[model samples]
Target: MYFSGLVSFLIKYNHLLLLLLSLEFMALSLYYGLFLFLSMMDYEFFFSMLFLVLSVSEGVLGLGILVMMVRSHGNDYLMSFSFLW
Candidate 1:
């Protein structure tokens, strides 16, 4: 419910790029928070590095998808994806 609400809010007022960015921010924050918690327990940076690497890869993939979406739709608005549903 919370995530759906966030998606709706992002769709209603944000550009597609902004939507992707916000998603990325949310993911990174969650991962980094975990990493910090883990670090405090054992001072290990490995988990954070692993998550950072993963997040970057996820970012690249998301960006590639965004590019494809824009090319196919010619616009970056959430409403433009109505055809998908």
Candidate 2:
């Protein structure tokens, strides 16, 4: 699942929304793997909780950027931005 998300991210770079979604997908897969590892190890779940919190915050930040991009540029296409040069 993680690899699939990465492939999507690499192949779908035309749109900011698609990139963010792929990133979130990758993060979710990592969270699931971490949770399983912790469970099998009989370790505390605090780390997993922290990881989830961080991933959610990261997703929120990405969405906020997406919103700003859409509002200013009128679309989510990455190529819509003008070059600084």
Superposition error at 75 for model 2 (Å): 0.3
Per-residue lDDT of candidate 1, residues 49-78 (tens digit)? 888888799889978987988899887876
| Candidate 1: stretches off by over 4 Å | 1-14
How would you encode candidate 2's per-residue C-alpha lDDT over 40-64 as one tens digit per residue?
9999999999999999999999999
Model 2: lDDT to the true structure = 0.92
Please tell me which predicted candidate would have the highest TM-score against the true structure. 2
Candidate 2 runs further than 4 Å off: 83-85
Give me the displacement of residue 12 in model 2, in angstroms. 0.4
lDDT of 1 at 34: 83
Give lDDT: candidate 2, residue 58.
96
Per-model TM-score, in order, reads: 0.69, 0.94
The true-structure Cα RMSD of candidate 1 reads 3.9
lDDT scores for all predictions?
0.74, 0.92
Model 2, residue 62: C-alpha shift (Å): 0.6
Top-lDDT structure, candidate number: 2
